[model samples]
Target: MDVNGDLVHGATLTAVLDGSTQPVGLLGALSQAHRIQRLELPVHTMLPVVLRQLMLPIMLDELKAPRDRREWGDRFNRGQFSADELERLEHYLGPHGYGDRFRLFDAERPFAQVAGLKALNGETKSVAQLVPSVASGNNVPIFSALCEADELRLEPGDAVLWLLHAHCWDTASIKTGAEGDPQASKGKTTGNPTGPLGQLGLVVPTGRTLYETLLLNTPVVPDGLAPDDRPHWAWDERPIGLGCNSPAAPAWSQRPATGLLDLLTFQARRVRMFTCETEQGLRVNRVIVSAGDRLTRTPEYDPHTVWQHVTKPKKNQPHQRPRRHISGRAAWQGLSTLLAMDLPEQSDGPYTSLLLRQIGDLRADEMLSEHYRLGAETSGLEYGTQSAVVENAIGDDLPLPVQALLAQDAWLREALLECVDQADQAARALDTLNNDLRRAAGGDPLPRDKGSKPSAQFLQSLDRTMRRLLVGLRTVGADESELLERGQLAWEQSVWHAATSDAGLLLAAAPPRAIVGRTVRNGNKDFVYRSGKASGLFRARLTDILPRAAEERRAAQKEGAAA
Candidate 1:
């Protein structure tokens, strides 16, 4: 306690977040545990301070990887890096710190604690903004869970939804209605702000609770739900008994699914964090978002709804098992986002919207089928998701892609979807012909101007990006498989040309194939060398040669250090 009797508290962020009980994680242990109430402090106010401290170190890590580098102490004393890696590192993490005051040990800090703050701060605008905002244009959702008193509420059974729907209540005018008002002719009066919503539960303000309870009705876990995103701390809804960790392990096992998880980068956004007494000192536990409330908007979604889930600083059942609080709707939303975010910036807007709709609409059989096509192992569901089902999902029609596919078959009947030899005359001729045809068919044509063409390097990058995107957008009937193959081939060729340019190799002498260097064996003695490999490996005395080179490199490093 402080001199004035104010409570002084401190905490350590765990290496990984507690998946289940973290009311803040994607799927919390309790959708309706203890509602968030009676806070030690407003979460929004504390968030900025927390993020500011967390981001500084994470930014520093991107500046340099500390554990690998041998040098220590001051920035000048530390070693250097290539111009390219250094430039890239600065482009994202910023050059404000440079190498000054950055320590090698700082990079070794737990990533989850430091890394997630940037997203949270960006979403809430909790961080400092002295200069004109570079992030003002960003479409991040504004965080308002902590700003208002009695804003967040949990109305059980969705009876409020029935009343509101029946009464034809305008959602925009929620604050204006009263219980006995002559609002008119749905044969019912308008719903009150603080009163009952028909037969459902009352609009209870969000309160805090120590224990999160997941009322498990069925043993079946859903398919496409990512266990990696689930809580590692979850225990069965049973008594705290001994021998739980016996039988080689506990009765439970957790294997993370390889599906969608967009909130991984911005993890803390899903979690509701607060400090309270645990068996092991002050631990952070999150509040789960409860469902069944339909009359009032959820706190997180409503910017106008000021109240948030409350706090429970004291815990009576510290050893109680953290069970799963399952809500089908929230779980589905979380999993759909996770699956759709397989590519860069995929979580943003119409792209993610399209993907989520498509994935959610796919059957479990279809998901598994698509999973195999994406080059993942289809051995078995073994991840506790074997019984998962996608309910009432009908696939959406993709008009543009369908049109593009139909025209591709109709106009360019020559099948230019070949995946090799971009530099060959026949391939170039086909490509030019395809472009002209695509233009005639009102599709995206290859860019051309002046008497010259785009560099092979540009063609490669564009083709690669377009291919990955086009492949992801593939539906059950779309003929995108061959298209994607061609794209991959183009990207590979572009990368090859770029590398050759970098190495200053003679483009005329270079063969079209990735392989180079003629076999020069001494009178048929069996030996092979592949110049196409990432590392040059002459495969005869490979073991001896590599060891000797390694030894020499170590010696050189030692000599350099000694000097």
Candidate 2:
């Protein structure tokens, strides 16, 4: 035959019984089948080459004899064989016809070289030899379990041998003259010559051939095989053919199936490893569900709902914690207002006395009393028991003589008197306001039964106003004393006006009585004359009598000290 201009030889056949064929015929058969055109050889080869190829299996059989015979003989003698020895013997017997032949071959030589002659041919030595060895050797009987046992039984040692043989057979089939069944090489390499056994019409079965042999020979149970009895390489599931059924499928046919099976198996193992039948598993499941729910579900409320719930007060809510009281500039403004109210101002002599009386009507009397009470309370003392100590001390009241001396320097006199007047006025106003505050806060009302009528609430309000006014006066008295000491009490007109108008005696006095005036002169005929006697007498009583009495008492105390 010729293919694509390459010369093709026909298929070559050999008889298992005869070791004679031409090498040309064998090469021609391979060429025709593999579509090979030329032979890259040193020379053309002939018949003995073919015969040698045919004789390979027989030679392999002969070589297998000593190993098998020795193994079987040892087992018969010893009653047991190690796993390795048993495996070697089984492998030796798998391809050969019978134990008798193996023994005969062991006894014979060059019989393998003889064509058309069986080593065990009609010899009585053959039957007995076969019987005992077959009975003793752990081969056919053990492997028979592959066909008979419901589940394949394999020992650990057997599994190791099975894997080893599987790999070996696969490797050997590729290399020429390697020791595996020639029939097993049928579809392996394209141009390879079939072995003598293959030519004798034996077909190699895939998958289980090696595995089954090992399973039968091994003492251990083949626990790994319960899931699938198929050979290790073919155990994977694959898609069945959609096309026509032809020759055996390719080795790669099960790839997709094997991958899927492995994936499923891995998932099963993971499930077994990670899952628990407890609350912990429930928590894990909840966490997974929560994560997935967050990704997929719509929110039920606005995101700010939590913040609003925290900040907003509910209906009928209980009272909240009180904030700290902060009195800043407004408190100062209140003080200022109280300071600027109208009260009585200071005057000289009996006029000073009358001014003091009018200031008392402004309720400064009550404010002074309250101030004294508060001071005594703070100091843990009785009112009037402690001597009055002015917070901002001032110079003693100026006598008329001292006043006259200061008046000689008009500017200095005016400054000193102005300070005195301002202090007195501010004190009166603060006292009045203090009294008013007390009244407003429902303290003791002023006496309406003393020939006058006023609402009790009005009286109380007046007392509160008086209290505030007195507080302002006290503040100004202290401040003005400081200014005097610092020498900064300049009499600004506006301040004077505010001082006199708000808290001076003018506010308390009645309009003066209108008088017709006349002039008098010592030498002139007609002069205006006026009598100022009553006012002069009153002033004389205040300035001379009262002060003279005080001086007399002080002088007596000094005399007593001396004594």
Candidate 3:
């Protein structure tokens, strides 16, 4: 498929079945010896999730053989597979096995689709809807040149590309209602749930080599297959209309997932593409889209999300839920959550992904090194009311040292998490400074964007410094407690400087009225708002917020008493 002017090779069932598919190369341009220089469609964050989904079943298949999970990881680290394993993988993925049912468009069966969808819906819409970027229907083109007027056309390959994306990350909106669903209103279903991936602030663990990445993301399954578990493609019988096995039950009905395979290959939406034989070969012109399976509850074992204990619970059972990513926020801002492990019992806190914990085990075993940099790539859609429209598509990659991945709340992880909190505190202090300056000038409270810009910029300035601190921490030895303290202090100083710089800006921008002084009511007593008072307040807040600064102040006060 030619996406963004680059040709991406599509993986075939045959290649995947024979264990010949190089997923890294398929997703990006490969350098000599099969190294991915950079990811193609870098903003297409769902691709990695989909790729992982594809490879996981294969991993499960391989583990079903007589071999330890550690042995597989060791072989992956060496970039070699046993001949017996290769043969078994082929048989497992082949047509003689599960691959027989994996078809893109078959008369009797289709991959991730209701076979008679068009006939059931009795309508089809332009294929432009498949491509999220292209404006179609009532959606006005914001950045895209193509609009409803433009001849929106897609080749088979591109159609498939977007088709997969639709299943994983499609926006929630009104959809065509199939015949079997009981929830349909006039042959339509409104308020549909967003694709499962849309619900997560997905963080995928990436490694240098494709083999290593596959193994890193694939969790170790000690006991092989659950008897009834299978991916969507491996289902023996086609799903009938909007129902699963039950003909009367609607597809919109919520149910618990059978296993990881079921969750990954879940048909989030029922879709059918109509193709035409053109001079340019087969092209998809129209498609039908509707809701597929909706999850009953968020899966606790989903490996791609950072989990945090819910302070306020809507339900009593799940103390944790996947953290949602904020738009325009750097991944490092959530470093504490991303690197967090289990807290001491009785202290329920944020935790890293299960897959990441597995990767940490690899690092502990020396299969991966402390200095070996890995990346945490995050992606998710920010939706408007009922997820009816796409507000923003968020995607970012933060390269992290292996020290951050150490198990059981490693020292580096704890230290980095503390620095992140300190940074947050500093940012809040700076924000308070800005608001106080505005108040002194007799100005009303600033809008959210204007008020928060200073703090946001302050954090942005600390990005490189934070990364440098991470690098430094990677080199620190376990016995070097004092060295670690010094490093933490250094990081605190960076935060101090960043906050004060923003404070300086606020002071410089202070109005003449603020300099002269203003009297304001302080709970029935008059209080003065002057430049000096504002500066003093800022300094006091900074001292309280910064640990090192506070310690220094306490030491000076104690010496003064001694004198």
TM-score of each: 0.20, 0.12, 0.82
lDDT of each: 0.23, 0.22, 0.67
lDDT of model 2 at position 235: 23
User: lDDT tens string, model 2, 297-398?
Assistant: 111111000010113335654212111111211111122111221222342111111112222222232212211211000001111112111111111110
State, as a TM-score between 0 and 1, how close model 2 is to the true structure.
Answer: 0.12
- Model 1 residue runs over 4 Å out of place are 1-242, 245-489, 492-496, 499-563
Better of 1 and 3 by lDDT: 3
Residue 264 displacement (Å), model 1? 15
Residue 222 of model 3 has an lDDT of 62
Flag regions of model 2 displaced more than 4 Å. 1-408, 445-486, 490-563
Could you give candidate 1's per-residue lDDT for residues 76-186 as a string of tens digits? 121223355345544433325222111111222211212121221123221111001111112111342333222222111111111112121111111211112233223
lDDT of each residue in 124-193, candidate 3, tens digit only: 8878776667786644447977877676777654565677688778878888887676667787887778
Best-performing candidate as measured by TM-score: 3
Local error of candidate 1 at 476, Å?
Answer: 8.4
| Cα-based RMSD of candidate 1 | 29.1
